[model samples]
Target: MALPPADDLPPLRAVVEAHGLAPRKALGQNFLFDLNLTAKIARSAGPLDGFTVFEIGPGPGGLTRALLAQGAERVIAVERDPRCLPILSEISARYPGRLEVVEGDALETDLAARARGTPAKIVANLPYNVGTQLLINWLTANPDAPFWTSMTLMFQKEVGQRIVAAPGSNHYGRLGVLAGWLTRSEILFDVPPQAFTPPPKVTSSVVQLTPLAERLACDLDRLERVTHAAFGQRRKMLRQSLKPLGGEALLDRVGIDPTRRAETLSVAEFCALAQAL
Candidate 1:
C-alpha cells in the first residue's frame, strides 16, 4: 500500500507510537509534536520564502513539517538519534527537494560550512542538555561570515532568563554576558512544561537571537575567562573572588571598584575587565 501523504501523515503521536520511539531523556529529547505550536514557531521566524532553514533535533518531524509547509526554500535537519532518522526521511520524501536530513551530532557538524551554499536561518526547539553549548558555538562562528542570519530557538525558562538577563539581575552571569556580547536576545514567549510530550519540570521559552553586526569590542576569550572567574564565585565581592585573576589588582587595572560583585557589573564593564586581563 502507498504510504500516507506527507502533509496528511499521521500525527507525531501516532508516528512515535507506531515506531515505539519513546523520547530518551539521556539525549535530552522532549518531542514537541504539537503542530500548532510548531507552526507558530515557524511563522515567528518570518518570511522563510527562499530561505534555507537549519533545524537541530527534529524529533518526529513536527518542526520539520512546519518549516516545509511554511514555504522554506530548503531545510537541512540535523538529528543525532538514529531512531529518528526514519521519521525525518519520511519528511524528506514528502517534501522532496525541500528537505535534507543530516544524521549526526549537531555539535560536531560544521554549520558554517553547511550554510555556505544558502542563505540560512536556524529555528528549532533545541535539546535541553546541549542547547547552550550549541548556541555558543554558533554565535562564536566567524562573525564576519555569519552562518545563520537569525535564531529562533527554545530553552528552559531559566536558560532563557540567562540569555536575555541584564546586569544586576540575579540571572545575569556568564551566559548573559556572553550572549549580550554576541547577539541581541529576547524572550519571545513562554511554553509551559505540559507542552512537551513528557513534560519537563520547568517551564520553557522561545528565545530569538540576532547576531550583532559588530562584536562588543572586547576580547572574547578574556571576557569568558573573567566572567568564569567572577561568576564562579557569584556571591563573593570582586576583591575577594577575582583574587584568582589578580584580585583587587585586576579590578584596579580595569578601574572598577574592588568591592563590586559580578552581578553589579555591566557588559561593558565586564568587557573592559576582560580587555584589561
Candidate 2:
C-alpha cells in the first residue's frame, strides 16, 4: 500500500528540530519560522503564478515552503550549508518538481546560468554576511541586461537606509550611488528582531528593487572609482579629499564646487566626475 502523502510536511519548527538545524551564528543564519511572515514576504514579490523565483540561504525551507504553497511556478533555491541540504531535499520530495536546491556558495554561483532564460524574480531573506556584496555584484554583472525582473530582499536596517537614501543623507555612500544608478529601490517593511528563530541584534527590513529600463549612460567602473575616492575620506572637502585624483581641478573640470563634500554630491555629479577623470 502507498504511504500517506508525507503529511504535507510538518511545521517548520518540527523540521528544524528533527534535523537539529539550530541557526549557526558563523553562517549568519536566522531562520524565519513564522508562516505568516514568510507568506507576507512572498506576497511582497507581487504575482508569482507564472514566474520563477530564486531564493538564497533557505534554511529549513521556511520561505521555500511558503513560496511553493503560494503557487510559485518554480523555485530555484541556492543553499550553501551541507547540513540544510537534507532538509531542503525533503521539501523537494514533498513538493515534487516544484523546488530545485543547488548546493554551493551563492557568491561563486552564476545566477544567469541557473535562470536558464526563464522569466525570473529574486526573493530571499539573504545571507547577512554577504548580502550587500551579492546585490552589488548582481546589479553590476550585466547592467545592460538585468536578468531578474525585480528583487525583494532583506537587509539590516542601516543597509536598507543606504539602499533608499538620498544623495545628501548621511547614510548615502557607495551603496547609495550604485543602487540609485542601477535600480529604483524602496523599503517595503521592517521585520522585527523577534521575527527570527535566533533574532539578530539589530532590526531588519525588506527592500524592493526594480531595474530601470535605461540608466544614466555612464561607465560603471568609472562610477565606482569616483565614489570610492570621494567617500574614502567623506569628512574631507572635495578639494582636499580628491587631491590624489586631481583635487579642485578635477571638481572644476566636472563643474562641481570644490568646497563640496562627497556626501553632498548627487549621483549624476559623481558620474560627471568619473567621466571627467
Best-fitting candidate, scored by lDDT: 2
Q: Over 4 Å off in model 2, which ranges?
A: 1-7
lDDT of 1: 0.89
Which segments of candidate 1 are over 4 A away from where they belong?
Answer: 1-6
User: Model 2 Cα displacement at 150 (Å)?
Assistant: 0.6
Candidate 2: worst-modelled 10 consecutive residues by lDDT:
1-10
- lDDT tens string, model 1, 1-277? 4333337878989999988999999999998877888888998998999888999999899999989988999998999899998888887888889988999999999977877667889998999999999988887776556778889999999999999999989999999998898889999899988889899999999999988888767877788789999999999899988887898888998799998899999999999888888
Residue 136 displacement (Å), model 2 = 0.9
Predictions in order: lDDT: 0.89, 0.89
Candidate 2 lDDT over 60-97, as tens digits, reads 98889888888888999998899999999998898899
- Show pairs that collide, candidate 2: none
TM-score of each: 0.93, 0.95
User: Where's the lowest-lDDT run of ten residues in candidate 1?
Assistant: 1-10
